[model samples]
Target chain A: MSSNMMTEVLNLQANQLNAGASASLEAVLNAPPEARAELSALMKLAARMKRWLIPVRPSSAYRARLRDGLQLAAGHQETHRALVETRPRVPQWGWLIGAAALGSAAGIIAMILRRRQTRKDASVAESAR
Target chain B: MEAEEQLIERAKRDATAFGELYERYVDRIYNYIYYRVGNHADAEDLAARVFYRALGNIARYKQRGAPFAAWLYRIAHNLVANFHRDAARRREVPLDDIVAVAEKRAGPSQIAEQNEDARVVLEAMRALPAERQQIVILKFSEGLSNAEIGKLIGRSEGAIKSLYHRTLIALRAELVKRGAE
Candidate 1:
């Protein structure tokens, strides 16, 4: 990037950064898709490393006052958790019945084994007697 | 009315509406401040204050142009504006912290280049004015748009554009100077 162009880009980016939380993203979206992607990627990167520029506090009582706004911006810049939840589509009852049947079969086999062992023990005792 | 409108209208009259508004904007506001403030605890406290102030005086809100977010930004802006004066703050991201963050994300070596570049850019951002600093963080870091920005700070779209441009120019100059330094 030419010095002048780089300056403009930097200025534009700074302005965007300073534009507060309310600036129209549509304008940013209007940027060439490549530029948009590049800008976003750059922003994301800077955001992650921002902690170095700003002050960090232990997550505790003094939470409101920012010691360094810019650095804090960087540190807190992570992938934002989605505000809305997407419900996953659940499957039908086939798996549920199959699981239940499998569990029931295991229980029945366990019972049968216990009974056979008890009968074997009783028969051995009677023979000894 | 928009969702913001619904939210604000309900909040304007009722306490639960106020809570709902808090719920809606808390993370966004918290994110905005957390990135700029550089600490989780401070961001949370400031965010609570932002909602507290908003809730306390919600009756004064006049909704003609812009959504509820503008008012919120205004509150956030005003809050952060005073924050700088109260404390002497350093504006450099420590290298150790970057390594720590990278280690948590992936192998440190793979993300070294990305980490350094981001650190440079963040330092440049820290060099900007509070107004500009807050705006840039909110837009880029927190990912809010211009219309939302305007509503938060109570500016017209055109005004927001002009201010945004000016702030960018100022920031770019700072970044260049920092690079040279």
Candidate 2:
């Protein structure tokens, strides 16, 4: 059998052969003794491959540890999320507004002190004259 | 499956729900990693990382028409790949694990022979290219269909089938060489 035919036969066995493939694998497999032998060998190999890699369950202790770890992660994420939500949020423009308010207050206080000092200095000058 | 979807949605917000998802997929993921890595300790570590990563990123996970399990498997595939690359080494099946498997399958008289066969097969499997090894493990260990495997590996079903065929052929050749030895 051609390599393509063999591939077709194997693909059919795997159940993923393309819908539009021309040759029937069944016909090819049934045609000759040599083909039959090849099919048998391939099938046997497939079965062996399947059988050898048995499904192994993780240990119970490991399962419990994973469960604990996931629970911890979930808790961590929840806490982190809650902290983000409840933590006092300074609005994006809050700092700018606060800085402007402080600057204006400081300016007013400085102007008042300067005016008082100027008035006192003028009175002193007039008395000296 | 609808229930699972709801569970996944709940899991996105609920720790208990995420734990349930953990319970459901832990073994399958662990098994898949075990076969890929050929050991228990690394498998467990990688499997844990897969879940933690999943939980951390669950909020961003969308259905995307694939099952949640597929998402987990993809995480697992990536972790295993990194594990391999970082370790810069490939581990064959440990002899004790092979013996344990062989003991479970056959009588005492056949234990030695079965162990040998198991070792040979595992070595051959490890010798396969990374993607092909994954295909073999997903196909045989997880018992996933070609379409399902394709979904996991991002390949067309036809491509998966062809890969499987070639994998089997290479495996057979390896086994024949072992027998000759």
RMSD of every prediction: 23.7, 7.1
Residues B1-181 of candidate 1 have per-residue lDDT tens digits of 2477777877665555565565566656776675565545456667767876776567678888666766777787678767755667534445555554343465656679656665666666666776667666655555555566666666655566556556655665666677621
lDDT of 1 at A91: 75
Estimate how well candidate 1 is docked, as a DockQ score: 0.02
Question: First chain TM-score in every candidate?
Answer: 0.31, 0.48
In terms of lDDT, which candidate is strongest? 2
Residue pairs clashing in model 2 are none
Worst 10 residues of 2 chain B by lDDT: B87-96
lDDT (Cα, 0-100) at B92 in candidate 2: 58
Q: In order, how many clashes per candidate?
A: 39, 0
Candidate number achieving the greatest DockQ relative to the actual structure? 2
lDDT of 1 by residue, A18-92 (tens): 444323345346556556654444443333323333333233223323324322332232112222234465776
lDDT for model 2, please.
0.79
